[model samples]
Target: MNRRDVLAAGLLLPAILGADTGQERSTFRIGLTPVFLDDQVEFLKRWRQYLERRLEAPVQFVQRASYREVTELVLHGELDVAWLCGYPYALNADRLRLLAVPLVEGRPLYRSYILVWDEDLTSRSLTDLEGRIFAFSDPLSNSGHLFPQYVLSMLDLRPEEFFRRTFFTWSHRHVVEAVAVGLAQAGAVDGFVWEMLNRLHPEITRRTRVIERSPEFAFPPLVTSIHLAPDRYALLARVFLGMHADAQGRDLLTELGLSGFAKGDRSDYDEILFMAEELQRA
Candidate 1:
C-alpha cells in the first residue's frame, strides 16, 4: 500500500480494535501526527499493544495531519496524551504536562535542517534560495516553520517577499518529497526525521542534500493534559521512562532509531519558547 493507504488504515485501526466488549475498562487515548509515522502502520500496532500491556488498560492511538490539530485535541481533553513537537508544547505548556522526550544519540536534543536537491551543490545557505519556492512542514512546527521564519526575521527578509512561493506539506517527510520532486526548490525539516528517513528510505533522502543545520533544540516530547488523573499520568510516564530497561521496549526503540525516553523538564524547551516569543514580536 502507498503512504496514504497506510495512514488511513492506521487511523481506522484504533476504532476497529478499540471497540467496547462489555469490559469495564477505560480507553487511554494518545494523539500522533503523520510527521514521522506516515508509513509506520506495523510499528503503531506493535507500540499500541506494548503500551496496553504495560499500562494494563485499553490504549488508543489517534493520528492527525498536523501538530496544531493534535495539540488542540490534547488541550481540550480529547486526548489523554500526545507525542508533539516542542513548539506546540512550549506554546501550551501551562495546559499540558511534559511526560517524556525521545533520546536521539543518547540526548533529548535535535536540530532543524534546510535542504535542497542533492545535485544543487552550489547553494550554501538559505539566502541562496531567496527567490525559489520553499516548503514548510507545518505552521506550528519549530524546525520546519518557526526556525526558518526566525532565520528570515534575523535577516530582515519576510517569507512572502523572499521566496517566490511557499507552502506547507503538513508532514516533514513530504517536505523532503517536495524538494526531491521539484515541487519545492528548498525546504526546512526536522533533522531527526531527515536522519530517520535516510536510514529507512534512503532512495528518497538521497535525492536531497542538507544545506544548513540549526542549533540543537530539545527533541519533541510526549505530553499529557494537566487535568489527567495523577495516578494515570504516573503510569504513562513510568512505561515510557522504563522503555529502555525492558527487552521489548528496547527493541522498539531500536526500530525507531531512538536511544530511549527521558523524564524531560519544561525548562528543556526554554530555547523554543524564546524563539517563539522573538518571532511573535517581529
Candidate 2:
C-alpha cells in the first residue's frame, strides 16, 4: 500500500479489532528529534511509560541522530507524532500539524542562547566572539542554528566569515558541554535545554555563561502528519494538553522539565517562519 493507505489503515486498526477483544490493537509511534535525546534518555523512558499507560496502547519511540531524519519520518507519515524543532515544522507546515507546545518558564516561548565559558569576559556580545570556534546543536535546529545564524545576518556578518570554525554537536546538551569543557570558544543552544542542564548537570553549566539571548520565539512543538485521521491526532492532543492535571502525568512533565503542554496553533510559529525568510534574504 502507499503511504496514505498505510496511514489510513493504521488509524483504523483499533476499530477494526472491534470492542470484544478487550485489548488495544494499535501502536502509537512517537518520533523524537535528536536535539533532546542524549541528555533525556531516562526522561524519554518515563515519558513513554506515561503515554502507554495513559492511552492504553503500545507506544514506541522512534529517533535518529539527526533532526532532519526524524522530521522527514513525521512528514512522510512514518511516525504518528513527533517532537520537532520550530524550523522544520515551519518549513513543512503543509505536511505537519501542531499538536501541542511545551511550556517553559510558564510560557509557550523560548529563546536561542549564545554561551561562552564563565571566565570568558572578553566576549560580551555576538560580535566579540569573532574568530572563535563555535558549536551548533543541529543545522535544522531553530535555537541552535537558525536563530544564531539570523543574529549574525542581522549584524551583516555571515557565519563562515564571522567565526574561525563551527560544528554541529547534534544535541543541545553537547553544545553546552562543548563550551563548558573549552572545546568550543562559544556555542548556540536551546535556552530550555540550557536551563535543564543547569539543574541536572551543574558542573557543566556552572562553567558556562550566556553571552547573548535571541528574543522570545515559538517553542519547539509536538506535531503529526496531516495524513493522520483527525480523531487520532485529537486523541494524542488530549493526552498532552491534560498531562499536567494527572498525578502520574504531572510527574512525567516535571521530569521532562516542562510546565505543561498547551494547544498550539500554526500561527504561533509565524515568527520563526519570518526569521527563516530573513536568513535566506540576507
Candidate 3:
C-alpha cells in the first residue's frame, strides 16, 4: 500500500527477468521509453523499488530503446504498466486499459506547440511552417507527430505536402536542439517536455520560441494489459492515486516532474482515438 512496500517487491528494476518472477512473485514490470530517461530515471527506479515492496512482487522498470520497441514490449506482454505516448495508446487501445495519469502542476493535461528559433518573431504561426524543414519527435509520439499532424490535416494539409523535409528527432530535447541549432526551421513537441528541458537544459530551450500552441490533451498515460485481472488492476489504481500523499512518494513524484497521479479512464483518450481514425480514413 505504501511506496516503501513497492521497493521491497522489486518493482524498481528492469523487466529483463523471466516470467517466473512476474507471475509467481505477484509483480509486474512498468516503464517509459528513453525519452525521459535522462531526467526521470531516478524517479522511475525509486517508484519500481517502492512498488516491489508494496505488492510483494519482484518489480522491474523496462528500458525501451525506441518508441517502436516500447509498443512491441507492451504488445508482447512484457510490460505490465507503461507510461506511454497518446498515439501508441490510441492504436493499441484494444489491448491496453488506462490506469493513472500524471498531473503536471496539478493538471492532467499537456499541449504541443510549433516552436521556431526566434522569441521576438510575431508571425511564426503553424501556417508559417509550410514548405519549411520541420522536425518531429517520432512517428509514434503524441505531441510530436499525431496531434500536430492531426491539426495540420484539419486545415487540409499533409505533412509531406506541407513541409519541404520532415525528420523525427526521437526526443523532445532533440527537437528543441534541432530548431535552436538551425538544423530545422520548426518543430512540434510536448509542452511539458519543453518546460522540463528548458529548466534542466536552458541553453537549448531558450533559443526556441513557441509559435503556436496545439489544443490541450491528456498527458502521457499509464496503462496495463487488457488481460490483467480487474481486482489487481483496481488495487494498482488505488495505490497510484494515493502515492503523492505519502512522504517518500511525494519526493519521487517531484523527481518525475509530476504534481501527483490521478485515476483516469479510457474516455480521456477519446480525442486521440478520433484523430487516429481521421488519419486512417485520410
Q: Pick the TM-score winner.
A: 1
Instruction: Give me the overall lDDT of model 3.
Output: 0.81
> Considering TM-score, where higher is better, how would the candidates rank from best to worst?
1, 2, 3
TM-score of each: 0.91, 0.89, 0.85
Candidate 3 regions with alpha-carbon error over 4 angstroms? 1-27, 39-41, 119-122
* lDDT digits (tens) for residues 71-112 of candidate 3: 778777777778888778878888888889889989999998
After best superposition, candidate 3 residue 169: deviation in angstroms?
1.4
Estimate every model's Cα lDDT from 0 to 1.
0.93, 0.88, 0.81
Q: Write the per-residue lDDT of candidate 1 for residues 1-282, one digit (tens) a residue.
A: 999999999788867998554333468899999876789999989999999999889889999998989999999989989999999999999999999999997999999999999889899988899889999999999999999999999888899999999999999999999999989999999999999999989999999999999999999999999999899899999999999999999999999889999989999899999989998898
Could you tell me the TM-score of candidate 1? 0.91
For candidate 1, give the lDDT of residue 129. Answer: 92
| Candidate 1 Cα errors over 4 Å, as ranges | 1-25
lDDT over C-alpha atoms for residue 208 of model 1? 98
